[model samples]
Target: MRSLSLLLFTFLCTCVPAQTIAQTVDTLMEYTAPSATITAYGNEPGIGTAAPVALLQQEELTRYDKSSLLSGLNRVPGVRFEERATASYRIAIRGASLRAPFGVRNTQVYWNGIPFGEPGGDVPLSFLDAVNTDRVQIIKGPSGGFYGPGTAGTLLMNTESIHQEGLFKLAPRYANASITTGSYGFLRADATIQRTKEAGTYNQFRIGYQRTDGYRDHSGMDRLTLQYTSTFRGQKSGAKTALHALYTKLDYELPGGLNPEQYADNPRQARPGSADKNASIHYHNLLLGLTDERSLGSWKLESALYTTGFYFDHPFNFDYKREANLGAGGRFALRRLLRDDLALALGVESRLQYRNGQNFTNPDGTRPGDLNFSDEIFSRQGLAFGQLTYTPGAWDFHLGLSSSQLDYSVDRTFSAEGVTGETEFTANRPVSVRLAAGRTFDFGYLYLSRTDGFSPPTLDEFRTNEGGLNVDLDPEIGTNYEVGFSTSVAGKFFPSISVFHFALDEAITSFSDDRGTQLFRNAGKTRQQGIELAASWRAISTTDKAIGLSFYTSYTYYNFTYLELERGGTDFSGQDIPGAVPHTLNVEVGIDLRNGLRLDLFHNYTDAIPLNDANDVFADSFHLLRAKLSYPFKSFNVFVAGANLLDQRMSFGNDLNPQFGRRYFQPAPGRNWQVGMSWTAAPKR
Candidate 1:
């Protein structure tokens, strides 16, 4: 705590009196969208938004090493990204990891305006290559009134360039390629090519491959990705259309968590019996999407359709599983100006999926011995939403409403006893509502909002890997209230502050049974509140001389606790929320010199985290330091990066509420280094 305070004070003292610069550089790093093209609301500027939102452009994204988004996303006040192993990712937005045993849930995700993720609420982020992403927009707090049924907010990712329309600013044709190598036997290569025709047609293609030996035993990963995006404006129809396609083949080894003793002895070793089982995952995925926008007289229409197909082959210490899935979804919306100062919009979205899975006993961890169970599952979810936005003078008002429903059925074809009939679980229809008001001032924007939402159980929580089915689990319902303000001081210092309180009923959390099966159950109630502060400063800027210095810092404070909870005859009321760290801070400094040379230094400090609902175990706090340097020539750039400069021993993703004090630690790599070079070819302006 003392060190954290000292660092914060030093950073503030160094940034306060810096000379102001032009708005161009500051806008690129952090700024409100000047238009609604990249957001969900109507066509308006940031003053019209009444909720907290974070936008990261390409320049801000490349400040990291480009290996993973963990460090980059941590810059966001209330967002947390964790990795249990190589390519095994999890995300929590303004919430704890109680329900997210693996993957992302509770939050809604979109790619290029098309709905992404499985119908069952699991987002496979591992399939995405961060290098291809051009921008990311995060809407904080509950946003089901516009995005569907979710309590943890929304994430919109744009892989295509923002300069795809209007006059062409870049060369008609361009190509870029890069390769990187790092410690722990990490290797990566990727290339991209783009072409634009005089007839208003643009196309881009990208391919990437990555492999790593990993830091722990039996933890290795390999992946191949291919993506294509095309956009064009109709010559006579006066309409625009975009097509997107993505494919990935991923393979990763899973080194099971370590117990306290094993961690103290050798944190690099695999869990007991994991070697005999050869635990790993193999996945193949393909996704296709299309988006179209056109004018219907005085109204505007936008629609999106997408399909996804994937196969999963996984082996664990207890069982081996094979699964296949196919899903499709689409969204349609229409917007119009009822009056000069008022606008209305309506949309509908639906998704359906079918999955077939078979589990087998793994005697040697490498091969299946006998089939334990075979089952099939079908899931469907849909939502209808409408919103009204009124902007009159300096006051902005927004109201949104939505109705959502979810249902799923499971049929067991074969089990230990015999064939079983189908079992169904249908959730009650829920209505979500949001109301917001904002006031814009010459110095800044101030806003407040209220949101009510519900999140249904995901397929992974309903059916465990051990073939156990749970139908009694209920959806989590919650209400959130937030207020925030952001401002810029002389185009040199940008700062923002947000405060929120969320109350939830029937909170969903996970637990492990004695047989190693992870399951979900509804806890009683919870009260969560937090404060977020973020600031960015351009300490010195001299574009003419090509010398610049900048600093960014974010701080988060969580005061979350259980209101009412009882499990297994033990009272757990009033305990701090497990997996919810009380405090987190991130600081980054960038230095730019002459001749396109740059350096970035980062520091991250995380408070101790409770590892169980009972509050009997906790993971100690730790500090992480990283640095990167780059130098550019005419057509190519070379860079070097290092992580964990202090060589701190730390656990990144810890398993919460393990059964009978079992393995709960996932240690991160001690130290690593990376070197890479990139080349680009383009026509002169």
Candidate 2:
């Protein structure tokens, strides 16, 4: 009890002053300028648009590291992070599956305006470092129109750019560094450097490294990343370029399922004589972008063009895989403010992507073996969208519409010792539309309506010779609906609530045939509904003593039932879909002390999920607790964190990836602690 009191006291002292000062200054600076200045081509509200839709500013992101940033973004309801290992994570939104070996399906991840996914629409989260991001946006449901056609969800991450304001003014400007250690052998370090000037030109660089000796045996990882952004401005146009690169080497022990006896006695023990696997992945991405703004009569024209390239390589278990992607896109927008009450924006965009890759398998456990399979694919898309806003008295109304078309083609070949053949090239075309509406009232309250479309399968679903497998899959479609309200109370408290439902059709499923080879099939209907609530407040405010509190919680209910199934040439009904957790809860709270000190608490709970169609294997419910404390000074920062405070063991999947067991596959680590410090000195002004 004494320790708890002290912890709370410390938190209150750190945050109060900052909160009070910010509020006072913001209130005093609420005066409006002479006229409303608006830019076209900007899709969403800018820095200080609506009270609820305001973009998070730069200061809000400074204290966060990669993992915390990802975890703290719970604003998007029904999004969950699947911990693959210490440094590897998969983001699952609204019950979307993350088990595809080739890559993640149904989700699209983007950095800046460029895609961070494989050409075939697989997003690998291991390549991104959240610590370096300036802002993160999550678009839920089947809103793939902004990216491509197949994704059901989109994660957009924006990194710091060189053209930002207030970067180069201070002599020997400000800088900071952070280090963290937790469960397993988790260790992470992040640092940033920036240079800004009054000429509208700036340069920023971020570097990060992470390593972990995983909870399970034979699971370990090392990851390194570097990113840079630079911008140059001319009279009416600007050129912005970003470079990002990452290298990850993972030596993970695979945990095959255990029999009944082994499970009951010791779940964390490793199976005997299992093969040790080493996997290495290299990712490189570069983006070059240009933006131009000009005026024609009373209207403004905004345009942007971007080109990006990504490459990947993996070598493991006598197999070598490699892939490369090149993509380019351009967007043009027209914007105008009509009278004093209306604003309009219209934009058109087109993107083209090409991918080439090959997978080779051999008995020698080395490269240059027999070419087992190879694939080459091409994808192209175009989109047109428009948004209009009208402000009349206390009511603010917004409307948006977008349409898209996608075309994809794939060529595949499979070669075995005796059987060698090429599958006929396949092509697919998918189209989609989206609509959204929202209204803001006088009391800082808002209501919204939205619908987004998602495209299903492509050539990868039908090519038999593509990867030594046969897939006769059909496209799956998704429709999502959402409603929400948000407002702040007492000028010091902020809160929001939202509810959403998603419906999926022709969902993809995989099953093994009599020959033991797996095949893909389109399954039945699945639905997910959930609610989210979050609040933040300044608990204590004063000149000499400061304190603050923030809390966020969310709950989700997901249900999946097989509408149709075929078993051994016979129909089987009334089976629960595997890997669907019915319920999930997440909560977080944090406090700041006056003397540059901070403390945070977090919790997560997930209900049981089915292992297989028969419900034979079940992953039980589990809870996790974590805490962190940090102190900052003029030149350096130090922090400590503890994870799995309760030593809870939970598994996400039934047999495929059973978490922390008596054997070597323990997914979560036992209680552990770590502390580290770093110092930074910025360049002279």
> Each model's C-alpha lDDT?
0.81, 0.54
lDDT of predicted model 1: 0.81
lDDT of 1 by residue, 30-116 (tens): 323223243755445443678888988766666666666777777899998888888888888897889887778888888888888
Candidate 2 lDDT tens digits, 557-660: 66656666665575545566666667777776778776768887777787877665556566667887767787865545677777668877664333332223
lDDT of 2 at 601: 78
TM values, all candidates: 0.93, 0.79
Provide C-alpha RMSD values for all models, in order: 8.3, 8.1
Report model 2's TM-score to 2 decimal places: 0.79
Residue 205 of model 1: what lDDT?
81
